[model samples]
Each structure stands twice: as C-alpha cells, then as structure tokens.
Target: MSALHFDEATHTYTENGVRVPSVTQILAPLNDLSFIKPDVLQFKRDLGTAVHKATELYDLGELDESTVSPLVQPYLDGWIRLRAELPFEILGMEERVFHPAHRYAGTYDRLVLLDGKRCIFDLKTGAMFPSYGPQTAAYKNAVEKASGKRVEGRYAIELRDDCTYRLHEMTDPEDWQVFLGCLALHRFKNKHAA
Candidate 1:
C-alpha cells in the first residue's frame, strides 16, 4: 500500500510533486468578487462518466477484458454475476440533484434493496482507505436530503479479479457530520480559490 497522505486535520493535500494547499490558503480571497468554479463542473462531469461506465457495464455485461484492468476484472465480473443472479435492479444511477443546501449535486452509483434492505453501493476502482468514509457519508446525506428518503448504509464494491467487496454500515450522525463538514470546508476554499 502507498503512504500518500493528505493532512485533512491541517487541511493540506499533496499530489505527486505539487505542493499542497491549505484550506485557509485556498479559501483566501482571490479577488474582490467570488465565483463558482469550472473545476466543480469538471468534477460533476467525471462523476457522471464513472456512473455512466458502471451502468453500461451493468446493463451490457462486462466489457472485453483488457490487460490494464485485469486485477479488477473479477470484482466487475462478480458484480455482474450478482446483478444477474438476483432480481437486483439498478433503481437509478447518476441521478442529478439540484438541492439548494447542497454545495453541489451528487450522483449515486446504485440504489437497490438487497435482501430486503435498502443500500447504497459505490464502485471503487482505486486504492482502499478509511478516509473515504466521510465522502461516502456526504453522498448519502446529499442523496437522502435530495430524495427525502433515508439511506440505511453505505458500501463499496471493490472491483478486482478476486471479486471482494467492503460493506460499511452507516453509524450515527456525528461522524457523518465530520465528513460532511470537511467537504463543506473544502468547497468553501475551492470557491474562494476560484
């Protein structure tokens, strides 16, 4: 595993050789006027792409195996198999939101009742870590707030050849708030930076 660290406690992030920016530094006024950013739009686009790809795979079956994503093939295959064997339906994927309280709209990967329980499964194609908890929670909060429905839990389908998954049951609201706050703070900084 890689030890890439983004000091959220300090509000710093380091990617490759670029110096990380602090939340305060980022939130600092760039000019007299404030503006919504293009990056946010791009982020929504990227999320849309991811959600679209997952849905395509789910609807059309697995893509032709490629040499690059071989390690994650089983994970996708397993999800395909699970999706096929059961009466599981893709309730909605990449549904957009226009909530006023939300910093930005969110896209949900899957909203389906599994074995009689409503669940949210996020497709993870990258590395694993505990840091993603808040982001997921924020998504849950956003979805629930937008849809006026309660989300019981959050999960990640780790797509690999081994086809393993990690299930995270949503805890109380406090921890969920922490993650949401972090995202909110980041958005504040991002807006200022723009």
Candidate 2:
C-alpha cells in the first residue's frame, strides 16, 4: 500500500486521490464538553508526541536518554520500566494503514507479538477514557486489513508522569462497531460542511 498523506489545510487523508477520514477526525466530535483550554490541549498533544517518539527510539535501541526533553522524561522513564517486563517482538512501529472497505486511514503505534499472539500496542500519556477502546479497535482493524493477518489482541499502555504505567487490554468487538458509526458520522459532517 502507498503511504497516506494528510493535508493539514484540508484536514483529510488522501491516498491515491481518494480522501479518507482519520481515526482522530472521526472521533473529534464525540469529545465530552470538559471545556479544556486550547493551550492545554496543545500541550497534551505535544507531550504525547514526544513520549511516542521516545518510545519508538527506545524500541529501536536508538534512544539517547540524555537528549530526551525534561517535560517528557518521566513518561519515557515509565515506559522504559514497563517495557522491561514485557517480552514481545515488535513487528512494526508508527505504521500507516488504510482501510479500503471503510475508507479511513490511521497511523498505528506498534504491532507486536505478545505471548504468541499478534496484538496492537497503543501508547497513551494521559487519562484513560472509554473512547480509547474504540480508537484502538479501529487501528486494529486497519492494521489487520493492511497486513493480511488477524489481530488477536489490542491494548492501550499508558505511561503516567509518576514513573508508573498501566496496561489495558482492549478486545471489544462492540467498540469496533462504535468506531464505524463515528466514521459514518464523520463522513456526513464533512460532506455537509464542504
């Protein structure tokens, strides 16, 4: 499959001239009215990005702990501690996947073999929410479609700021259907918005 391109200006993913919604875009409208400030949202996004980068580097054995920024160091440390306990083989990292059947695209964090099971590992650096299940489910479907392999498990691993972590196993078929509903809503919203 060709690499999917996201047009920042249009806020859409285009693959082979077909515009497809991203996982985030599909879930954007479903966010609860917590009234989080814009700067706070941006900060969280930045922190998550940094932590993901650090995790990727660590997985590839190219991480330089000294160069990791101070703000994300704690999260990185937590991930490191957690990674030590899990003996899994990394199949792919930061892999871009497209679902032709659903016409959506997303970048999954990692595909791994954990305990002889093919699973998707999604990393989070913030509070755990029910929406995360649907998000991970969507990634699982897309990744499975792209790889022609069945994903037997899905998980969300959260790296807390206190140098601790939580591993949540998310294997709910209902969540995948929920994501499909969100995709339909997203298409309707975007189609009318244009």
The TM-score leader among the candidates is 2
lDDT of 2 by residue, 16-38 (tens): 88777789888776676368888
Q: Name the Cα RMSD for model 1.
A: 12.8
lDDT of each: 0.53, 0.87
After superposition, which runs of candidate 1 have C-alpha atoms over 4 Å from their true positions? Answer: 1-55, 60-72, 84-87, 168-173, 191-194
- Count of backbone collisions in candidate 1: 3
For model 2 the local lDDT of residue 130 reads 84
